[model samples]
Target: MTKTRALRLSGVALLIVGASMVVGPPASADIPFNVAVERDLGLSPRQAEARFAQQDHASAIESRLRDTLGAAFGGAHFDPSTGKLVVGVTDPAMTAVVRAAGAEATEARYSQRELDGIKSMLDETDAPAGVTGWYVDVYRNRVVVEVNRAAATRETSAYLDRLRALGPAVRVAEVTSSPRALYNVRGGDAWTTLAWRCSVGFSATGSGGSRHFVTAGHCTQGAGPAYGYNDEQMGSLGGSTFSLFGDYGKVDVTSAAWTLAGTVNRYGGGDIAVKGSTEAPIGASVCRSGSTTGWHCGTIKAKNRTVIYINGGAVGGLTQTDACAEPGDSGGSFITGTGQAQGMTSGGSGDCTDGGETYFQPVNEALTAYGLRIVTS
Candidate 1:
């Protein structure tokens, strides 16, 4: 293709990823993760627990594969049904290396390095209109791009044509309604000050050692003095960022009555333990707790994605999921298995009623970006 044509198609890979977890409330235990799995996936409590245990083991093997394969590594994910680690390798020779680590190996067409470079080219393009989002899907070994329509216009068609020149690594998907950043602070929540209501994501300490609770940046934007759910005034909004680089913010909690806990409220059920923020692999089961949806489980669809919201400009480097969320659920907690903090709810297409796709700002990325540590037991 000509240079001009290549430039037209050079938007981000924009792929949709697939992974699964659960929505729960089980009867109660040291961890309620199994309960969610059982509830959402139709698995028995014992089976759900076993699946998580398997995922943990898969995660360990994945770590080994990462160190062993290095640049040969394409990507890693869990087999949702079997809970076995699936490692993608650019070289067929590396299959033995991954299988030696107790993971299923699959040869991939594109190397992770090449994929990353292509993604960088896509990012360099001006935001093409009507394009909602995109990400890299390792399972498909392609960058999946989501468009509002297949044939929106001649320009978009030309753009996609150029994108195809980059190789078979880019695929376009047509989607409904655009992604939006949900900002709603309301009553009867973790910490809602104004009429708008946003849920708390995770409580942490800033680099300077001040206690604060993290949430969606869009939530804290224009937020007056924040108040606890009990209607007591807490500290004001501190460091916050909106849909630009990422979507995350922190609210200083200086009140004596409102001590931050290492647990996420499940709304109608048990509190989720906050073990750590180590992100789970793709296709692992993940659960989100929002005031609106209560608790919903799904799989990690994709990572390092960019979702263009209606009002929140363009927030990049997000994790996509089929999990459901609504307006008041903004900034709620997304956790994997028993207790790993995944991300804060950004936005999605539909609601819990009919099911929808949502995106999150990965907790680890947010923590690293703000130099904050999640308060954990």
Candidate 2:
């Protein structure tokens, strides 16, 4: 496969093709990709390649299954244990159908629609700060509401009761820290405003042929002019949203000196070519690049998670991952080993040293929201 070629300019370069710790073989240009997955995820390059193909096959057929099963469609996830796709269905009759489609089928208590409805109700109601976030766990076939154990109080308990009353579809999980937006007043590769810094996500183009780069909304929201780590003005915020709508922003690359290449900086490891923006399923391996943490690999834990930050700002429709991130890592690139674009780092509690859950705003959502096309190799 053809890979993105690096573009060097004025001692600054748009890097292309870096390795990641995920289950997938990189293109021919990314030999380090296999080695990275082997070292971090503990899989041989061959094994990782096979698993990536498997997940891609599963993702490809999922839409057809959803249409065929209709309301009986509970949810679908990649089963790492079996190295196959396991689709949940509320109807027993759908089991054979799923199997016929080459996926394992399991019984589910609630359909995806039912569980989403429950989560939607929670999103509409204001929750105590003790509530960190919530998401539909496809494997469990339940909507999980995560709470900060120490932050919980009588008021939080009452709120939990109301959530539980929504029925058995709701499950509570206790976490130690609350989620927050990851803007440091900082790194995929270090872009900055006057007072804060964040990483560049993906490069893209507007419908009118304008060059731009995408990042976390919190990084660009009222943050003013964006600049490269070199302190050169790159552009201005074109669009941004950090509320229930989602956490995403676009920066028009107004500076001719800067290039909008479809690549992510892998720090000293080189770069990773962003080939596409196909969302991976939960349980799939993924890796992210940031200026603060460099590159860290992890598995996707959940999808469509709604995180309520400690500052009272809430961003819905986020994908949760086991990847570790920190302040200033916001807006970094999250990609699969195959070089597929995943998302931009939003925030989460914990550090790279201790390991913690991190959330990302899906790249596809950001692309769609802005009617922009991702620049790909």
Quick one: best lDDT, which candidate?
Answer: 2
Error of 1 at 163 (Å): 1.4
| Model 1: CA > 4 A from native | 1-36, 185-189, 193-195
lDDT by residue for model 2 (148-238), tens: 8798889999999887787788999898888767774012567766546678899999899988888998777774677776667888878
Per residue, candidate 1 scores C-alpha lDDT tens digits across 32-124 of 545556666667767767776777788788777878888898888889776799988988999987877888999888877777677666766
- Whose TM-score is greatest here? 2
lDDT of 2: 0.79
Once fitted onto the true fold, the runs of candidate 2 whose alpha carbons sit more than 4 angstroms away are: 1-36, 185-187
> Each model's TM-score, in the order given?
0.86, 0.89
RMSD of 1: 10.4
Instruction: Report model 2's TM-score to 2 decimal places.
Output: 0.89
Each prediction's whole-model lDDT (CA): 0.73, 0.79
lDDT of 1 at 84: 90
Residue 288, model 1: Cα distance from true site in angstroms: 0.6
